[model samples]
Target: MKDIKAIAMYLPQFHRIPENDQWWGKGFTEWTAAKAAEKLFQGHYQPREPLNDNYYDLMQKKTMEEQADLALKYGLDGFCFYHYYFKNGRRVLEKPAENLLKWNDINMPFCFCWDNTSWARSWSKLGSKLTWFDKEKERVYDGNGVLLEQKYGREKEWEEHFNYLLPFFQDDRYIKVDNKPVFLIYRTDEMACFTEMIDYWRKLAKIENLEGIFILGVNSCNEKIGMDGILFSGPSAYWNPIISSNHIEYENRNGIKCFDYETIWKNVMIAGSKKNVKTYFGGFVDYDDTPRRGSQGVAFINTSVEIFEEYLYKLACKNLSQNNELLFINAFNEWGEGMYLEPDKKRKYAFLEAIKTVKEKLESVVQDDNEELTSALKANKGLSGNVEVINTNMEKQNGKFKEYYFLLHRWLQLKEENKNLSKYFMDHGYYRIAIYGLGVMGKHLIEELKNTEIRLLYAIDRNPQLIYPDFEIRSVDDDFPRTDAIVVTATFEYDVIWNELKKKVDYPIVSLAHVLNEM
Candidate 1:
């Protein structure tokens, strides 16, 4: 039932590479930048720490093993590792990936995104000026000097690079679409001899008796020649002045750039809206490079697990149903960029838990739809697939996705800003309660009540035949069990249900909506 693959972008820079050691200093890793970060202003969340202070080194094989376990455990399909290969087969930051390949025991599926940008020490050290967007538009990391240059030699160089990648590509764990290994490269227009290089790779792939590579452009839709697809990079794909109203604005007090997390996600939600067959969608867990760039960095403020799950769930339900392309999350462990899915101190595993929640719910919806479709086929005794009926059912499930978020958001908000349902029940002496109308809202109410001291007696429904293994169900026709109150979920027909239910049971009747809003 998984309609689209969820591949988290991975960073291998957690392990010390020789080039990084020489350029930055000895023992320098992503943890160095993340650990040294300090809050630049009030409300700034900095010095992102891994849970249990697990500042792990990727060089160890167990790191990869645990990472693979975490990813698979939390509904991620694979990892799209950032591959750093340059001209003349000169590569750096490859130890982790090498180990992943070398150690067959680690169960992880992965692909590559060639991060072709040149690196320099100056990108991190922004002196007194600290102005946002002064040089940011030119590149993500702006610096004067270049530590290494990315160049493209002729066919020979292309062949050499392809040769190095062959083993990983050939590995059974490499993700593929239609039997072709998926590859991503940034700035295809800027990658010299890009088309020629892709063509050469395809030729070489064919020689190895494998399908030609499926190369996707990284936020680049410029060329149509050699590229097979396009994977839009979140915020970057959605960034630009004319795109919309939400954009970079500097802090008046400190001249630092700050963005509303909601605003940018609103922009990102529009990505892949048109259902481009050759396009894949992308999203980020969160983006805050302040750990790496300090005040000179760009940050999206006020992000929480609830907000993230809402955005991701909405995006998944909207887009994944229409495309066959992989949905790439910005990163699994780019801690330096502040865009990792790895568990951290403040959030713990809430973000990862959110992924599991969304994935299971989506799959459940899909399974329901398929079962309904099968029932329709059997009833019709061979109709024309009942495609229209399937769409209608899907649309309803989509509405449920919207409803779940809306209610969850409002419920959470009420608990903090106003009187919550739990307090209402306790104040009213409804310690033991029964839910009337065991439908969507009733189920949501049941879940919300679990955090409180209220005890669920049972549920009342017209058709009590429905089986819910989690809780007991009772027929409204039967003598009601003793309870302090009955919370009705049928808000639209609350009056009618109340009149009928009151005649059957001696308990106060209240609408779930009234309880939530009256708070």
Candidate 2:
């Protein structure tokens, strides 16, 4: 249930870019917008400052490295960077991601969400105006309603764009699903060419030796396109009219929209539940784009760490209940929009701690068992027995850890349904069972069968010396003991373990997962 991956949406507009300099002023960055923000109402946070005034320059490698380390420490799965691409293969504000691709030591797993929306002056009109007075005589680029246009061209343009991104797709740190690079499109509604483009990109990815490109729409995606899934962009998740009516509007002198934070989050969860397609539910740290949209901005009030964590925990539980893979967070650092998880002066690491707390609670059982496993491995590393086996399983430990936890979850579901494993074995005439693999699954099996008629005779494990089960501990090399069945708790290696056990004992061998599967 705790296996959902938490991927945070990332904003990379921190550093000063040439286009921003031309549009806003010299040395313009997201910090400029945040610094110039005015308080919209009483008790409203404005001019939000970073912790220790750490307004980072994303172009700096050290800053990015620190960001990756901090995120990983807090248990985030990865960052989904907002990728900006415009007409004719033009990309803006790309230095941060470019540097990420170039700098291998950052250690952050990442994917891209192409924000297909054009840079329109109306939406961003609150910021400093375009200083291109003596420039842009051309009609389209003339600082009209549009600052930058999003024009999707034909095959040539698409191929050019993919060629440029091929390296990123091929990068070791790029987040992939089932061997395919996961690519996100922020607004598939605006992309008329999405179906063709993604289909083409998938073919391109295959030609590059990739399985294919895994596409997930950030907002509304055309379901016919075979998008791998859809991610609900939260805080204003498409702002459904029916749900938007639930907003508890605040009386403000300005005409900006005010939403109850809790209401928006509830809407997010409800929206995800109704979706028939796969969805990675999203959450926001906070939302107030007054800096970017001024009085026209949309703000969600009554935000707190406690409330965020509560909804986030609920979101995780919801996703897990539905078998969703990840729960994405909005804006890891979108300071301009006032949505960020990076430490700030007002709430230094509270948001990050919130994520950590949720993850810890979700992985409580896994962590406890993992801690013991770690200690056991460390203590027995110098020992003569099972050293080779331990070394061999080291590479598979991470994947096996999750696999075991999944079985634990399945077992719980069966218990809730009154389909007891003990009853299943008893019904099949297996009164005595030996648990194979005394790690987490084995320990859990023993606990489940305790005091039940399905007696646990002994536990067979690789490192029998390390495990202190109530029953006798025996290595696979030891003489076989007669039992009704041997439940192989190390599900990943069930076949190999089963074969080994079958040669020595006449007992039936079954995987812990498969036992639940049959039941």
- What lDDT tens digits, residue by residue, belong to model 2 across residues 182-285? 88887554344466577678788888899998888775523324478877677766354332223344545367677777777766554422233465657788
Write model 1 residue lDDT over 379-465, tens digit each, in one string.
332221223344234433543464345445657767566555888888778899999987778877887788689999889898879
Error of 1 at 304 (Å): 1.2
Evaluated at residue 151, the lDDT of candidate 1 is: 62
Ten-residue region with minimum lDDT total, candidate 2: 126-135
Question: Which of the numbered candidates is closest to the native, going by highest lDDT?
Answer: 2
Cα lDDT, all candidates: 0.71, 0.72
RMSD of 2: 21.9
Clashing pairs in 1: none
- Please list the residue runs of candidate 1 whose C-alpha ends up more than 4 Å from where it truly belongs after superposition: 121-144, 241-253, 272-277, 370-519
